[model samples]
Target: MSVYNQPRKRVIQLIILGMVSLIVVRLFFLQVVETKYSKLADANAVLKKVIYPSRGIIYDRKGRSILRNEALYDLMVTPASVKKIDTAYLCEILKIDMEEFRKRIANAIKREGRVRQSVFASLLPPETYGKLQESMYLFQPGFELLLRPVRSYPYGAGANFLGYIGEINPDQLKKEAYSAYQQGDYLGLTGLENTYESTLMGQRGIQYLVKDNLNRPQGPLENGEFDTVAIAGKNLRLALDIELQILGEQMMKGKVGSIVAIDPATGGILAMVSGPTFDPNLLSGSYKALNLGRLLVDTTSPMLNRAIQASYAPGSTFKPVTGLIALDEGVITPSFGYPCHGGYVQCGRFIACTHKNPGHAANLRVAMANSCNSYFMHLYRLSVDNNKWGGTTKGQVKWTEYLGNMGFGHRLGIDIPNEKPGIIPDTARMNRRYTGRWNSCSEVYVGMGQGLLDLTPLQLANAMCIIANRGSYYVPHFVESIDNDKSDLLKKYKEKRDVATHISADAFSQVILGMEDVVTSGTARGAQIEGVAVCGKTGTAENYARVNGVMTKQPNHSLFVGFAPKDNPKIAIAVIVENAGFGATYAVPIASILMEKYLTDTISVKRRPILQRMMETVTMSAPMRAKSKVDSLNSVSYTATAGEELLKKILSN
Candidate 1:
C-alpha cells in the first residue's frame, strides 16, 4: 500500500511542475521575447507621430540674421477617422468652397490609404489658424492642426543666392539619395539652401502617444519610453556683408550685369550681386509654387546667378594676364615697348588702340594704364612666336597653359553649383576651328580680351584677387564657418592654391603700378577715389546680339576690375554692365563707388552725384524689356518711363 501511494504522488507532482514551467515561459514570451503581439495591440490605441526639427538659421558675417524659421500651422486630416462634421463651417474658415474641400479629401485618400494622416491645407495664416483653433473641437479626431516651420527672410535680398525650399518630387523619392525622406518632406531647390541642405535639415524625431476610441491623444504611451527627441540643425555663418550687398544691388539697379567682390585675404566673397534680382521673400510661404512659376518664365533670367553663370569677353581685363604671361616667359621685360600708329596694322588686319597719339609702343605700365590694344598685341605675338618655342602651335599651347593655371578655360571649383568654365581657345580648339592654319597673328584678338576668350564675373574677379594676392588664392566661398562644425566643411577653402609658380612678385607690382596709373591719369581716371591707392583696368567688350531677329552690333559691355590700397589689398572687385557704352563711363563709377563703400564704409559727398547718375541710367534694350516678365528688372523705375523722366530731371539739375 505504501509503494503504490508513493508512485501516484510522484506522477501528480511531475504534472504540476510541468504546468508551472509552461506558464512561466508563456509570461516571459509575452513580456520580453515576442514583440509582434504587443505592437499589434498598441497600434490601435497609440499614435506614432513624427516631429520635424527646426532648420538652421543663416547669418551674415556681422552676425545679422539673413534667414530664420517662423512657426506655421498645417490642417491635417485622417480620412479613416472622419465622422459627420460641419463642412460649410470648415470651408468658410479656410476660405475654400465645398467642391475644393471634396477635392482635397479625395487627394488625401489617393495619396495615402485612409489609415494615414495627410496634409489638407498647409502654412495657414495666423488669422486662419486662429479661427480654426476656436472651432477645431467640433471636427473631433478627423482634423488637427500640425505645427510646421516655414522659412522667412529678414533681409529681402539674395533671392538667387539664398534659394528656396520646396517639397520633394516623385523623381527625388525614387532616387537613392532621398531614400531616407518621406513623401511630404521639403528640400533646398536652389542657392545656399540647396548646397547646405544636409546641414540645414536636422534629424526628425518620433513620439508615441495613447489615444481614445475617438482618436484623441490621451497621453504618452508606455511613459514616453519609445519617444525620441529631434536634433536641431547647425547654424551657418556666411561670408557676405549685408550692407555691401545692399549697396551693390542698389548701384546695379538700372543695369543688366553682375558685380563680384572678394576679400583677397581669405577668398571670402564680401558681396556678389546679379542685377534685376527679385525679393527673396517671394519664394517663401504657401505662395511659393505660384511665385516659382512666375520666376521660371521671366525672360530677364533673374534666376540666373550671372556672377558665375554668364560668361563675357574680359576685354582689356585680359591685358593683365597677357602681360603676366609675357613677363613670366621672359619674352618681354617690364621695360619692353611697342610702337602704335593709331591702330595695329602689321598683319594687314587693323586693330584699333585707345590712344589717339601715334608713337612708340609704351612700356608695360603705360600700355596697361592706357589699355593700349597694339601694345598687348605685340606682347602676345612675342610670347607665342618666341624662337625658343620653335613654332606658333607650341607657343600658343604654352600661352594657353598659363591661362589654364590662372583659372581660365576651366571651372574654378567654387562652393555653389552651375559655375561656367569660360571659353579659352586652345591649340586643339584653334586647329579644329581653323584646320590647323591659325597662327598667333590670326588669334591676336585674344591679346586684347576678345576673340575666343571668355570669363564669368566670378572668374574675372578672382583673377584680380590672384594679382592682388601676388601668387596664391583660396577658392572663393560664401560660408565662412559653421556653428559647432566637426566635418571638413571649410578644409578645402583653407588650403592655399598658387596659380603661376614662376611669375615674380615684382612683375605683379609693376603691372599693379600700371593699373594704379589707370585710375590716376589713364583711361580709368574717373574711377579715382580719395585716400585710396586704386589700381584698376577698364574694359569695353564688343559683343553682338540679335535685335528684332537681325544680327545687330549692340552697345559694348562696360567692365572694370580693381583692388584698392595697392600695398596689402583687402577687397578685389569686378563689375560688368551690359549694353553700356564705355568702361570708364558706367563700369568705372560703379566699381569706384563700391570700392569706396567697402574701404571707407561710405562714399565721399562729392561722388554722391555720380552714384545718383549711375543709378538713374537705364540701358536695357526694348526687346529685353518686352521679354522680361518683371518690369522693374529691365527698367530701374517701377514705372519705367515715369521713373526715367524723374531721374533724368533730378540728375540733369
Candidate 2:
C-alpha cells in the first residue's frame, strides 16, 4: 500500500485526535465551567480582619510591669447600611434599650451614612458580641467588628491610689478644659494616673482605610506606609518600693489609720498607704463590672489617704516644734525650768496631761524629752498672747510669722496628688470661731499638740524628715528615674527655708535630746533598738465626745513620730492608730518597725519574733466593745442614711 493512501493510519489519527479533543473539553469544563473559581469570588465578597498590635504594658519603677493588655473586639454599625436588621433584636443582643440603640445607630448614620462605618460601642460581654457574630451574615455593608486593646491590672489593686480610668461622660466632654479630647478618650481619675496623665497617655495616631458593605477594612486605602504608627506610652518609674509598700500595708493591717515613710535625704516617698487597701486591678480598663460604692464608701474609710488626706491631733510628736520655737524666740534658756510635779497643765477647766513623771522639766531639752505640757503651755501663752505671759521674744505676732515658715500654714506642695493642708489654726479662723480677740485658752493646747493642731500622718513624717535633715526637707515624692535616665528623673524638692519649725538648732537639738532619752528608757521602750540610736516622741490626744452638745468621755488618738540613727537620720516615719489608747504602745512601735525595716535588711531574730508578735497583738485596741475589731477593719456596723454606703463597700471587699 502507498504511505499517503494508508487508510488505517488515517483512521488511528482520527480516533486519537477525537480522544484528545474529548480530554481537553473535560479539562476546560473542570477548570472553568464546573469549579467556576468560587474560592476567589468568595474571597472578594466576604471580609475578614484581626486586631493590630496589643496595647502596651505598664511597668513599675524597676521595670517590672504590673499591668497587662490583651486584644479585644467591638461591634460597630451604621444605621444607613442597615439591611432590615431587627432593631429590637440588635438592641437586645447588645443589651441596650431601644433608645440607646437608636441614639448610637442614628449618630453612626449621621457620621458616615450608608457609605462607611459610623460608631461603635464597647464593654460588651463575649456572649453579646457572639450573638451579633452569628447573625453577621445578615448584616449590611456599614457593620464592622474591630479589635483593640483593653487594660488589665494583674492583681486587683490600688483602687484609690491608682484610680480607675473610664470612658468620658457627656458632662466631662462638654467642659472647655477637656475640649481637646474626644468622647471615647481614657482619662486618669486619681492618684498617679491623674498626675502623670501626659506621659502615661501617649500622643494618639490615626489610620484611614476603605471598608466593604460589612464595614470591614478592604485594605489600607492609602497603603501601609500612610498609616501612622501608634507609640506606646512611656513606662512610669514610680519611686515606690513595692516591697516596702506591701510591708507597710501589712504592718498597718487591722488598724484604722495610716503610715508614711520618706527617705529624709532624698524626700522620696518610700511608702504611702491608707488602711484597708483594695486591689488596683479592680479598676483596670478591661475589668469586670464591680460595685464601686461598695469599694469606696466604708466606715473605716479605707479609700481615704489618711497619710496625706485625713488630719489628726499630732499628740506629743509635735512637742519638738514648739520647743524649738520657744528656744529660738528665747522664751527660755538651757537653765530655765518648769516644775511638772506630774506636769498637769490646767487650761481653764481642762486637766490636759494625764501622763505623770515626778519632779519638773528643767529646761527646753528636758521639756521636749519629758513632753512637758506645762513648759509648752507657758511658751504658747507667751507666743500667742502679747497682753499676758510677756516673757518671750517680741510678741505673739512675731511667733505666728515664725510658725508659718515651718510649713504649718499651707500645703507642702508635694508631688503626690490630694495632700491636705492641715489646719494651722490661723488668727483668721480663730477670729471667725470666737468672734473676739484670740486668748491664751485657744492657743495653749497646740503647744502640746492637743487642740486646733490638725496634721496628716504624712505631714508629721515630713516634719520629722525636716528635723532629721536639720532645718528643712524637700517635699516628699515618689518616682526616682525613668528608662535609667537620671536626667529624666523627677527633681528632688529642696528645703523651702532654713527651717520648718523656725526654732533654733540648739533648742531643736535640746528637744531631740529628750526624744533620745525616750528610746533609752521612756514610754517608747518598745521602739528602742540594741545598736541603732532611736529618737521618738509618743502622744495620746483626747478626742472629746459630745452627746447633745457638751463633751463627755475622751477617745484618744495614738500617734508617734521618730527617726533612726538620731545624730544624722536616714529614714523618718509617722504612724497613727486611731482610737488606740496610747501612742507609745501602738503607733511608736509601728514607726520603729518601719524605720528599722528601711535602714537594715535583717532584723535580729529575737527582735523579729517580738516585733511580729507585737504587730499581731496590737491594733486600734479599744475598750468600746461594739466598735472593737482587732483583725478586720471594716467591722464598723453599717446603719442606713450616711456612712452606710461606705461600710458596704468595705464589707463587699
Candidate 3:
C-alpha cells in the first residue's frame, strides 16, 4: 500500500463513522423519549371502560321519594371480539328473530367501529337478563352485560311535570354543552328532568382493565392505580304535597282542564294537575319509546303540562286586576259607583252583566263580588280616557306596564321547561291588531277578562298569590332545595318581587273583600268552606273552536281562583274545567274541595257527598271519552261505580 492512498481511505472511514453515530442517537430518542408508540401498544392490551354514576332522587315536600332508581342491564357487544357462537339461542332468550339479531349486529358495527363497544340490547327484561347471565360464557369476549340505572315513579302521578329521560341524540352530541357525552349516553328529555339536567347528571369515572389474548377483560390494570371515582348526582327536594297532588288528579280525571295550587307565602306549588295525563312510568324503562309514540299521537294531548302551557281567556276572574289598575291610576275610588241596567249600551255594543240589579255595580267591592261586566268595562274606559295620559295609546302603555309588574305578559320564570308566557295586549299589539286606529272602547272587554286577554292556570294561581301577599310574591318553583349542592341553581327563586308595591294597600283590601263576597254570596258561592273564610272568584270563559275551517261555539270553560283564610293566607289555587256549563257547578266545587283538603287535611263529613259526586263526574265528550284510553293506560281503575262504592264506604265509616 502507498502512503497517499492510505490518507484517502482514513478520511472516508471517518465520514462513515459520523453517519453511524447519528443513526444511533435517532433510534434512542424514538424508543425512549417519545410516548406515542408506548400508548398505542398499551391500548391493545388495555380495556378502557366508563363508569356511570347513580342519578339523583327526587323527593316531595314531606321527604317521600317521588322518583327512584332501579338497576337494569344493557347488552353490549364488541364486533371485533366476536367469534363463532350460538346466535340462535341468544335470539331465543332475547325474544328477537334472526333478522333482528343480524340487523342489531350490523347497526352496532356501524355506530361505533369494530374495536369499540356498542349497545346491542338495552334495558333488558329481568327474565332475559337471568338467561343471559347464566349463558354469558358462551358469548365470551364479544358480549358483556353492563349495569344501568333507570327512573321509576312510586306514586304514578305528575307525569306532566316530573318528565322522563332518554338517550342523547346526534344533534346534542355535536354541541359544546354535551361535549363530554358519547353516542349512547342517556339524558333528561322533558319537564323537571330537562330543566335540572346539569345538576342531576353527575361526573363520570374511567377504569382500565387488563386484556387477555382474545381481548377479554381479566382484571383491573395495575390494581386500578389510574382509575377515577364517579361522583353521585345531587338529590332535589320539592315543595309538592303528594296527597294533595293525588286528590287534584282524581278530581280532574274524566275531564279536560287543569288545576294549579300554590303556597301563598313561599310560592311553592302544592299540586298541579293536567287532566287526561298518562302515568309517568310509561315514559321510563322498556316501553318508553312505544308509550311515547302513543302519547304523541293521542288527540287529547296527555303529555302537555297544561297548567303552564295552555292559555285561556281569564273571564271574570281577571276583573280584580282591572279594578286594581283603575284605583292605581286615580281614575276611580273604591266607592266610585256606576249604574247598569243589565248591560253597558253606551259604546253602541250591549255587553251584558250577569246581575240585572241596580246596585250590583255601585262600588268596587260589590262589582267584583257580582262580576259585573258593565262596571268593569266602564272602569277600563274611564282609566284609558283619563285626561292625564293625553291619549288612549299612552294610557294603554301605562296599563300594560302595571300588568307586566303584576306578573302578566311574560314568563314568571318557573323552575321547569316549556313554560308559556301568555298573551297580553299592549300598545304595539293593539296597533297591529287594530291598524293604529283604536280607542279605549276598542278593547273594553279586557276589563271583564275577555277579548285579547289570555292567561295560564299557573298565572291565575300566581296572581292570587300576589293578591294574597298584598302585592309581593316569590317566583313559583317546584324544587325548594337541593341535597349537598353548592350551585346557584335556585338563586332567582328565593328573591321576593314586590310588583304591585306602587298600588295602595287600601286598593288591595277592597279587592280582597270583594273576593270574599264571591265565596260567601256571589258567583262562587259553592266555593265557601266552613270556618275557613275562603275568598274566591268564578269565571265562565267563552269557548270557540275551529271545525272544518269554520268557527263554532262550544260550551264555556268553568274556572275558579281563590285563597283560603283570607288573612295570612296559606293556600291559593286556580281550577279550570273545559266544556263545562258554569263556574259554579264544576270549577267552584273542585277548587273548594282541594282547598278544604289542603287547609284542614281532611274533608268534613258533610262534604263527603260532594266529593263523591266530583270523583264520579265525567265532563269529557262521548267521542273524546271513547277515543282516549289514558285512564286504562295509567293502570288506575277509575269507574263511576268504583267511586260511588268508595265514597259510600267512607261515609258509612
Candidate 4:
C-alpha cells in the first residue's frame, strides 16, 4: 500500500511540471519570436506618408499641350502636436481670424482625432502660398506644407472634350472598383479624362517615416527600405487638331448647336464642338466645385456634350440611306422612274415636297440630287410591300437590316462616354404603336427622312465615313496613340469592319454622283469648295417642344452631312443648328468652311467674308439666351471677333 501511494504522488508532481513548461514556451514566443504586436505598440510614434504621382500630359495631333499640371500648396495640421506658437501671426499670414483658426483646429480634431493629420487649407493661391512659406518655420510641429498637382489647360478650348477632374466623393470611395483609393483623391469626371482614367492616373507610392514623441516626422524609417517610387502617368496623343478645335469653337460662338469633323480615312475625330462652351480653365483649381455647381443648374445645358449625346431626326440627311436601301433591294434601279406632283398623295394623306416642281424622279441619281420626296416615298412603299418578301412585316425587317448596315439606329461606339443610341423604328416598336394594324402607307413619312428617325451627330458623321470607305469603316475614336503602345487599348479601333453586303461599289458611285450634283447646282450649293468637289445633303428637321404645357412646333433644326474631294474623300462632317432654319443657310456654310480649312489649310481669300459673317452671327433665340447667358459669358471678346459696331448690331438683335 505504501509503494502504490508513492507512485501516485510522483505522477501528480510530473503533471504540475508539464504545465509550468507549457507556460514558459508561450511567454518566450510572445516576447522573443513574434514582432508584429511589438511593432503595433510602437505605431504611435510612426507616420505613413503618401507620395502622389503626376497625371499624364495630353497633347493634340500637332504635339501641342492641351492639358498640363501645375504645383499648388496645401496646409496640413496635427492637433495633438500643436504647442504654444504664434497663433495670431499664423492667422494673419493665412488671412484667417484667430477665432476661425481655433474653430478649424477643433473641427480637425473631431474629424480625424488628435493623433491624425487633417487639411487646414487647400490649394492656396500663389500669393497666399508665398506669404505662408516665409513664416512656415514658426509653426514647427503642428503645421506643415505639402505640394499637390492641379490641372491647367493652355488651349482654353475643348472643355467638354477634355473634361474636368475633382476630388472623389464619399459614395465613390465606398465602391469596390475604388477600393484602392483613399479619401481626398482626385479623378476625371467626364470626357476623355473619364474615358481613359486608368491609363491617365499613374501609380501612387508610399513612404514610412519615424516620428518623435510629440508625433513630428524625423526622417524615413530604415532608410526608406519599404518606400515605393511613384511612376508618372503615360502621356496621350489625341487625334484632335488644336487649331481645328479652336476654329470650330470660334465658329460656334453665340450659337446653340454642334460641329463634328472626322478623318474619313482612319475614323479619327478632327474637331468636335458643342456651342455655349466655357473655358476649360473654369473647371480647374479652387473654383472647380463652385463653377461645376453653377453649370449643373444653368439652363443652357452647356455641360451637355451635344455631339455624342443629343439625338434628332436626321431629316432630309436620311434620304441617302433610303435611296441606298431601295437600290440595294432591287425595288428601284439607277434609272427607275416615279412621277411627282408636288408631293406623295397616298392613303388619302398628303405629304408636301420641298421641291414642288412637276417632274419625274426619272432615275435614282436624279431623285437623290433633287431630293425628290415623292420618289423616295414610292421606293419605301415598293420595298416594304415587295411581292418577293410576301408580306409587309418581312419586308420591313429587310429594310431595318439595311438601316443597321448604314450605322443608323445604333450608337457609333465612339470612345467618349454618355453616347446615346438613336431610335430606328423596328417591327416590335411599330407593332406596339399600331397594335399590329400598320402598313407601308401608315409610315410613309419615314421614307422622306421625317417622322420616327433619330440620330446623334457622331452617328451622322460616321455614316458619311462608311460611304467614303465605299463599304467599310473603322470605329471613330479620339486618342490615336499612347506612350507605350504595348497594350491592346487601340486594337479594336484599327480593324476595318464591313457591314455592307449585297451592295456593289458601283452602287455607291451612282449615289455619289447625285450628291455631287447637290453641291454643284442642287440645294446644298453653299457647301461647294473652290477646287475640291464636295458632296453633301441638307436637312431641316421640324422640331416640337412643350411650350406653356402645350406641345408646339418650334423652328426647324438645321442639319447637313457631307464629304470632300468626292474621289478620295479626305474629311466627312456633320453640322446641326437648333432653332435655325434651312440646312443650306447656317449648317452648310459652317461645314463648308471647316472642310476648306482642313483640306486647304486656309480659308480661300474669297471666302474670308463668309467666315467673318459666320463668326459675327448670333443665332440663339431669346428664351435660350435667357436660360444660358452663354453669349455674354463665353462669346469671344465681342470687340475682338467683331468690331464694336458689329457687336452692337449683334446685341441689338
Candidate 5:
C-alpha cells in the first residue's frame, strides 16, 4: 500500500478532492443567490406591536372640555394557543376572587373559540391595570394589555343628550356596512353620541407581525413596515352654555318634564334638559359605584330622555300657528273680525272664552293676546271655511298641508339620534280615526293644538325660532360644528336650509307684537327679563285620564315658549312641566332665569350673593329646603339703601 505509484490510487484521491470542492460551491450559491426562504425565516424572529393614538377631546364653544380620555386597559387573550392560565395567579394579580377569574377566562375561551379572534376583557381601569402589570410575569405569553380609550362625559350628568356607547353587536356591524367595527368595538346608543358616532369613533389601527410556531413575538419584526398610524376622532364644539343648562336644572327642580333652548337667529341649541337626568359619567369613560347604583335603581326614571321623546298637545301654545295660518291664507287679517263675547256659541255647547269682551267681536291682535280657544277654532275652520278647493274634503286637506309647513307632523331632522317624528293628522289619519266621516268638527280641535296633534319640547322650541326668524331657520343642532373628523355633517347641514314656515314679514310682526304682550303684561308676565325685552306665549292644556298605571286628578301640562330682545331676537326657548298646573307659575319663571343667566350674566337683581345663597338652599323638595335653611337665608339681610348697590352690581356685571 505504500507503493502509491499506482495510477488508480492517484485518481481516487483527486476524485475525493473534487467532490469536496463541489459541495463547498453549492453551499456558497445557496447562501448568496437562493436566500429567499432563509431571509424570511430570519426576519420572522421579532414581533411588532402597535399602540393606539389618543382620541380627540370634545369641547364647548368656549373651548371647555365636554369629553375626555381616561386611561383604561382591555385584557386580550388568544384562547386556542393561550397557556390555559392558572386561575389562582390570575385572581391574585387581577384583584379578583378565584370564582370570578375562572368565569371571566372561561367566557373569553368560549368567545375566542367561536369567533377565531382574541377576546377582550370586560373593562379594567388604570388602577387595576397597574397591579396586574406589576405581576405580569405570572400571566404568561397568552395574556396582554391592549391600551384602549373609553368615552367620558366629565359633567357627570345629562345622560340622554350626551348618550352612551356600547360594544358593537352583530346587528350593528351589518347596518354599518362601511364600518371597520369588530365585535368588541363601541357604538353610540342615543342622542348626540349616536348621531355623531362615526365622527366620535375614530378608525381602528392594525399592525402586522410574525409569530413563531410557539406563537412568541420576535422583536422589531419589520420595524413597523406593515403598520399604519391610527387617526383620532375629531373633537366637537357645542352651542350649549353650561351655566345656562345648570340654571334650567335648578328651575325644573323636582318636576318631570323638559326644557329646550336655541338661538333664534342661528338655530343652535343652548340646552335640552330632561328632568331626572343621570350623571353621564356613569354611562361611559369613568364611573363610580354609588352614582351608578343611584341612577340604575332611581324611581324617577332618570335615564329616560324626555326632552325630545315625550310628545304633548300644543294646548294654548298652538294658538299662534293657528292664528298665523289663518292670516297667511287671508282667512283672517290684522283687521279680520270674529266674535268672542266671553265665548263662541256653537251647536248647543258654548266654547267659553277666558277673556270677556262686552262686544260680540274682536280682531286678530285681541284674539292672539287673549289666547281665546273659540277664536282659533273658528279661524282654523277658515281654511275649510268656504269649501272652495273643489270640496270640503279638499279644503280640510289644504289646512293640514299648511300646518305641516310650520314644522309640525314630522321630525325636524335634528342632529341628535332617536328623535321622534311627532304625530300630526291629515286626511288619511282622520279617515282611519273617524272611519271616513270626518269634517270641520273632527278638525277644529287641531287648530288649538289638540286632537291628534303632538309636539316635543324640542319641536316647540324650533317652532318658536321660526317665529323669531320670521320666515326660515337653520335646523336646530347641538353641535356648532363637527370636529374636522365630521366635516361632512357640518357641510351637508350648512347647505340645507329649512324654510317651511314662510310668512310675510308683516304677518310675523303682528304675531311678535302679540307675544310681547304675553310676557310684558299677559299670561307669561313672570318670564319678563328686567331690561332684555322677552316675548313669549303661555299654554295650559287639559288632557288627563290615567298616569303610571293609575288614575289621578292631574290638571294639565304647563308650557311656555319665547325669545328675547323683542326688537332683534337672540335666544328662543320652550319649557314643559307634566302635571305642573300653570305655565306662568313654574315654566315661565325658569325660562326667565335661564335667559338672565346667559344674556345678563346674573341670576337675580336683589342681593346677588344673598339671592344665590337663598335660591341654592331652596331645593326641589321641601324637606331639602328646611326651616333652618330659610331662617339662615332670612338672617342675611341688607338695608334698603344697600339693596341698590347690589342691584347695580347684578345688572352691570
Candidate 6:
C-alpha cells in the first residue's frame, strides 16, 4: 500500500507542475512578448486616420493640362467628442442655420456612429473655409477641417466626356468591383473618369495617431512607424487636342449635335464635342450637386455624350459603305451604273434622288458623288439578293457579318463609358420586323443610309478611319498613355485591327475619289479647304419624334463625314447637327473649318469670315434656346455675347 500509492501521488504532482508552467509562459508571451495584443489594447486611445492620395491629372494633347486640383476644405465632425459648443456661432460662420446644423450632426451620427468622424459640410467655398479655419479652435475636439483636393477644369470644355466624380453610394459599397472603396470615398461616375477609375484612384494610406480622452490628436503614434504612405495617382495623357475641342465647341454653340475627330494612324481621339455642353467645373467644388441637378432636369440633355451615345440614321454619309459592300460582294463593280430619272421606283415605293441629271447614277464614283438614292438602293438589293448566298435570309446574314467586321451595329470599344452599340438590322431582326416575309427590296433604303440602319457619330468617324486607313483601323480611345504605368490598360487600343481586310484597296480608293469630288464639285462644296484635299460626304438624315403623343417628322439632322489629305489621311471626323437643314449649310462648313484648323494649326484669313459666321449661327429652336442654360454655363472661354461682338467687329473690318 505505501510503495504503489506514493508513486502515483508523485506522478500527479509532476503533471500539475507542468500544466502551471505552460500557463505562466503563455500569459507572459501574450502580455510582454507579442505586440498584437498591445496594439489591440491601444486601439481605444489611438485614432486611425486615412490619408487620401491625390487623384490623377488629365492632360490633353500638346502637354496642356485640361484639369487641375484645387485646395478645398471639408468640415468633419465626431458626435461623441461634440460638447456644449456655440452652435449658433458655428452655423453663422458656415452660413447655415441652427436647424441645418442639427440635422447635419444627426446625419453624421447616424452614418458613422458617435465616435467616428463624418463630413458635416463638404467642399466649402473659399470665404466659408476662411471663416471656419479661423474659428476652428472654438469647436475643439468635436470638429476639424480636412484638406480635400477638388477637380477644376481650366478649359471648361468636354464636360460630357471628361465626366465627374461622386461620393460612393451604399449600393456601390457592397459591390465586388467597388469593394476597395468606403462609403465616403469619391469615385468616377461616368465618361472617361469611370473608364480609368482604377488607374486614376491611387493606393490609400493609413495613419495612427495618439489621442487624448477628448478625441483630439495629440501626436503620431509610435512616431508614424506603423503608418502607411499614400502614393499619388498616375497622370493620364490623352490624345484630345484641347484647341480643336474648343473650336468645335464654339462652332457648335446654340446647336444640338456632336462632333468626333479621330487620328486615323493611331485611332486616338483628337477632339470630341457634344454640343450644349456645360462647364466641367460646374460638376465639382461647392455647387456640384446643385449644378448636376440642374443639368439632369434640363430639356436639352447637356449631360448626354452624343458622340458615342446618340444613334441616328447615317443619311448620305452612309452611301460610301453601300458602294464598298457592294464591291466586296461582287454584286457590283466600280463601273456599275443604275438609271435614275428622278428617284427609285422599283418596289412600288418612291425614294427620291437629289439629282435627276443624265449621268448622275452613272458608275460607282458618280453615284457616290451625287448620293443618288436609286443607285445605292439597287446596290443593296443586288447584294442582298445575290444568287451565291442561296436566299435573302442567308444573304442578309452574310451582309450583316461583313457590316459587323466593319465596326457597324456594335460598340467600337472606346475608352469612355456608356458607348451605345448602334442598331444594324440582321437577318433575324429583319425576320422579326417583317414576320419572315421580307425580301431584299423590303430594306433597300438601308443602302442609302436609312431604314433599319442606325449608327453613332463615333461609329461614323471610325468607319471613315477604316476608309482612310484603307481597310484597317484601331479602336478609338482617349487616353494614349498613363504616366509611370506598367499595366496592360492600353494594350487593346495599341493593337491594329483589320476590319475590312476582305475589301480591296482599289475599292476603297474608288470610294475615296467620290468623296474627294464631294468636296470639289459635288454635295459638300462648302467643305473644301485650299491646298488640302478633303474627302467628305453630306447627309440630311430624316428624323421623327413624338410630340403631343403623335409621331411627327422633325427637321432633318445635318451630317458630314470626311478625312483630310486624301492620300495619307491623318484626321477623320464626323459631325451631326440635329434638326438643322441641309448638311451643306451647317455641317459642311463646321467640318471644313475644323479640318483646316487641325491640319494647319490656324484658320486662313480668307476663312475667318466663315468661322465668324459659323460661330454666330444658332440652329437651336427658339423655345429651346430660351430654356437652355448651357450657353451661359459654358461662359468660361466661349460665350455667345463675346462671339457676337467679335463677329460684329470682323464684319465692320
Candidate 2 lDDT over 368-387, as tens digits, reads 66677777777777566544
Q: Name every residue pair that clashes in candidate 6.
A: none
- Let me know the TM-score candidate 1 reaches against the reference structure: 0.89
- Model 6 agreement with the true structure over 143-226: per-residue lDDT tens digits: 988777878777777788888998899888888988898857888898878899998888888898888877778999899999
Worst 10 residues of 2 by lDDT: 633-642
Q: What lDDT tens digits, residue by residue, belong to model 1 across residues 1-653?
A: 68879989999999999999999999999988999778756766778777888999989888987788989888989787888988889999999999999999999989865656788998887899999999998776788888888888766666777888888988999999998788677888888888999999999888998888877789998899989998888898988887677767767775799999999899998889998777776677766676668877887878898999999999998898899889988988989888886788877888888786744356888788778899898888889998898898899988999888888889987777788999998988898889978878888889999988889999999999999989878999889899998999789988889887788988888888888988898889988889889999999999987879998987899999999879899899999999887999888998888888778877787898998887778877777767776644323211223223433443343
RMSD of each: 5.8, 16.0, 3.6, 4.5, 9.6, 3.8
Off by over 4 Å in 3: 1-40, 636-653
Residue pairs clashing, model 5: 45-218, 46-218, 46-219, 47-218, 156-279, 156-280, 157-279, 157-280
Overall lDDT per candidate, in order of appearance: 0.84, 0.65, 0.87, 0.82, 0.69, 0.87
**Clash totals for all candidate models:** 2, 17, 0, 0, 8, 0
> What are the runs in model 6 whose C-alpha is more than 4 Å off?
1-41, 635-653
Assess candidate 6 and give its lDDT: 0.87
TM-score ranking of the models: 3, 6, 4, 1, 5, 2
TM-score of each: 0.89, 0.77, 0.93, 0.90, 0.81, 0.92
- Those runs of model 1 whose alpha carbons end farther than 4 Å from true positions after fitting are 1-43, 547-550, 631-653
What lDDT tens digits, residue by residue, belong to model 4 across residues 1-653?
Answer: 69879989999999999999989998888778988677655557777677778999999888878888989877888888889878898898788898899999998887566766777888787888898898888887888887778888766778888998877777998899888777667788898888888888898888888998778788998999988988878888988877677777777887888988888888899999998788777777765676677777778789998998888887888887788778877777788878787877875888877666655477777777788888888888889898889899999888888888777788777887888888787898788889999999878878877777778898889989888778788889889999985899888888888989568877788778878887887789999888899999998888999989999999999999999989889899999998889998899999998898888877776787887888888888877677774544444311222223333342233
C-alpha displacement of 369 in model 2, angstroms?
3.5
> Which candidate has the top score in TM-score?
3
lDDT of 6 at 109: 81
Residue 441, candidate 5: how far off, in angstroms?
A: 2.6
